[model samples]
Target chain A: MPDDNNPIPHWQRQDLPPMLSRRFEFETYSETRRFLDGVAELAEAAQHYPNLSFGKTYVSVTLDADGKKVGPDLVALAQQIDSLVAGTP
Target chain B: MPDDNNPIPHWQRQDLPPMLSRRFEFETYSETRRFLDGVAELAEAAQHYPNLSFGKTYVSVTLDADGKKVGPDLVALAQQIDSLVAGTP
Candidate 1:
C-alpha cells in the first residue's frame, strides 16, 4: 500500500508517471470488462478518473495529477481499485 | 449506424483502422466515468470489449475484431456504447 510519508513501494509505483499505474490481466473479455466496471464506479464516485486502456485480456490503468502534485486521493483510488480486483470490497 | 451490408457511414465510421473508433467528451471526470461504466456493462454482457482510453474530461473507445473479420457483434457493441452514452438505455 502507498502512503504519504514514505516513497511508494516498487510493487505499488508504476515508476513511469507522476501517477500511479498498473496492469491487470483477465481470463476473458468479460472478466476484463467486469474489472473495468469496478474502476469506472470507483472513479465516478470519487470524481477522479484514470486513463484506461484495455483489450481482450488485459487492462492498463493510469492515473496522473496532470502535472499537479500527487495527492492522497489518487493513492486511495489506486488502492480501492486493487481491492476491487481482489474481490474483497 | 454501422451494418453488415454497407460501408460504415462517415458519421459512424472511425476511419482509422480495421476497427471502429470514436472519442467522447464529458463535462467532468465523473461524467466520463459514468459513460465508461455503461461501456463496461455493455461489453461484459456481450463478451466483447473495446479498447478504452480516458482522462479527466474525455474518453476514446476503439474496437477491433483483432484481425478477425469484423462481425455483427463488434458493430452492435459500438452502437450499444453510443446509445449508452446517449442515455437511452
Candidate 2:
C-alpha cells in the first residue's frame, strides 16, 4: 500500500486532461466565468460539451462519457482558457 | 509547458482524494457494486456520503461541496476496500 505520508500527489492541471471526469479550481468568480466561456467556445465547435457546476470560486465539469481520452481533452481546453486568463499567451 | 506526447500522468486511484469532487472507475460490475457497498458503509458511518451514478461497470460519485479535504478522506476509505479486493489485506 502507498504510505499515508507518501500519499500520491494530486494530478496537476496539466495532467488532468485525460481523466474520465474533471473538476477545476479557480481564484475568483470572473476567472471561473471566463474559463466557462472558453469551454463554451470549444463545446460550440466540437459539440462535446460537459456537465457544469459553478461555485463561488470553482467550476466542476464532467463529460458525458467515461472514455479515458475524453477527460484530458476537455482538461486541455480548460488549461488553454486558463492560460488566456493568466496573460501567459 | 508540457509535451503532448508526454502528457501529465492521470491522477492515480491513490492520489484522487483531497480533490473537491471525485469519480471512480472499476474493472467489473461486481467490483463496482462491491466498492459502492464499502462507500455505503462509510456513508452510513459518517453521514457525509456523496452523489452516485451507477453505470454498467463503473460508479461515479460527486460531492456536495468543493472543499479539498473531503475528496481525499473519502478516497482513502475507498482505497482501503480496493486493497481488500486485491488480496493485499
Q: Highest DockQ: give the candidate number.
A: 1
lDDT of the candidates, in the order given:
0.73, 0.50
Best by lDDT: 1
What TM-score, over all chains together, does every model reach?
0.64, 0.32
lDDT of 1 by residue, B1-89 (tens): 35666533322454345688878888876687688778877877887767878787888888877776667878878777778666522
Model 1 lDDT, residue A27, Cα:
84
DockQ each? 0.57, 0.03
Report how far residue A33 has shifted in candidate 2, in Å: 0.9
For candidate 2, give the docking quality class from DockQ: incorrect
TM-score of 1: 0.64
Q: Write the per-residue lDDT of candidate 1 for residues A45-79, one digit (tens) a residue.
A: 88777887888788888888667667888878877
